[model samples]
Target: MAQLTSIHRFPVKSCRGESVGSAVVEPWGLAGDRRWMVVDDAGAGITAREVNRLVLVHPEITDGGLRITAPDLPALEVPTPDPARQVPVAIWSSTLTAAAAGAEADAWISKALGVAARLVHLDDPTRRPTSPAFSEPGDLVSFADGYPVLLTTEESLAALNDVVLASADTGRDPLPMTRFRPNVVVSGVEPWAEDDWRRIRIGDAVFRAVKGCARCVLTTIDPDSAVREKEPIRSLAKIRRWDGATWFGINLVPDTYDVTIRVGDEFEVLEAVAPGSGPLRPAP
Candidate 1:
């Protein structure tokens, strides 16, 4: 049986995440995951894609709200913003109202990134639904690109590393799972076994696999030095490239909320979606 080996969540979007022993599965996503984001003057989301240094800002979820710590910068604690102070923000094709985290947070984050930025929180995740093409009715997501959660398997990484070592032009250093920023890391699965999974259950919570997550340049950035390289993407381009984008982890939407998923939780493959078939029903 496959077991969850690790769990992580980003309290703020596009920044480094915090590893957690267990996390509550919410309707939108892991509770407190990507509920906050940094926005530009136009209120459009800004990510590490343009400001790689943002990864250096580590955020920890606190009882008061969020505390962010970064190199050469003082830690800043921010409380949740008032719902009435919402500002219009756009994330990809989806646009919604988000509450601004106030001028202090804006100043702190702006200085950290060396760009004009404002911190905003999704006061209501339900305001946006997962793409109808890939999700069921009422399936909601947080500030995550498209899905509530992302799942990756250890075997796939090993397999990719093997390919990387074999390729002459690609750097052979093994890539850490952090490159993908998966919420749940599983073990005991064959390489890329999740590509066909339609539904799975971990602990008491069930989840539906919606689609494969497409890779981006962010994966090429070294989380430690913030240096961008060409290995994983260069190697993945040769293996998983299609439609102009490389593919990696699978995106998942929870079937049940309020359940806590812990590391070491055994997972069951409830259903597998056949090629050309629609969503598969979970086994009874």
Candidate 2:
């Protein structure tokens, strides 16, 4: 009887996310989720480590198109266009051809961050390859790390905060869920119940919880403005590290089909689809 209270999609990875009233669940990941990324001249990915200012960039899908605004510059606009010039880029293990959003986007990012960067679209069918672990013969993905959606529970965060508060020396501010950047934030569940949920139904959409999401420096960086803090990372390091990798959130495998998910949708836990067999530790 747990309900899905919120849904979010980060069109661009590691940047601010858009709180959607509804969205489509596709095999490649949430439709339009992580469909764009900021990269340097070599086509390597960029993150808060390379440029802290990247955290300052906030993006929202506007009626005109995708609008990117920062603290210092005017909003940069990217119109939804036919896939532009194809460019080569790598997202994790997948080497794919992404649509190049071109020089205007490049100039804006470069000027704002004082670094060479450009915007690339994750729409190329030929270059993008689906994860071998989950692809059906010839599936393709835009820019998701692996799965279609990343799920987290508010109860889990509350539990982690409780741990932080119980310890006297941490001196950390409890963070908003934004720091974790989850696609689905569920409430009313036992802390970490998602770790073992095999099939989860939210609204009309159903997702198969697959694996625990490995955490990275991105978790430590504030998504809104790319500010880095020690308490969260340090605290997570103390409690959530597993198998040499720090992790947060659960990665999900959607039943390869089009599922409509909207805001304010209700979720029903039909069964205990999967159960966590791994050790519970704080992400390091």
Count clashing residue pairs in model 2. Answer: 14
- Model 1: which residue pairs collide? none
TM-score of each: 0.94, 0.88
Candidate 2 TM-score to native: 0.88
Model 2, residue 17: distance off in Å is 0.9
The alpha-carbon RMSD values of the candidates against the true structure, listed in the order shown, are 2.6, 3.6
* Model 2 misplaced stretches (Cα beyond 4 Å): 125-127, 134-140, 168-172, 270-276, 279-284
lDDT by residue for model 2 over 145-223, one digit each (tens)?
A: 7766888888889887876676747465777888787888888889877665666788887766656787777777776
Q: Which lDDT values do the candidates have, in the order given?
A: 0.88, 0.73
By TM-score, the best candidate is 1
The per-residue C-alpha lDDT of model 1 at residue 259 equals 91
The sequence of per-residue lDDT tens digits that candidate 1 reaches over residues 22-140 is 99999999998999999999999999989998888899999988999888889999998999998999999899999999999999999999999999999899998988878889999
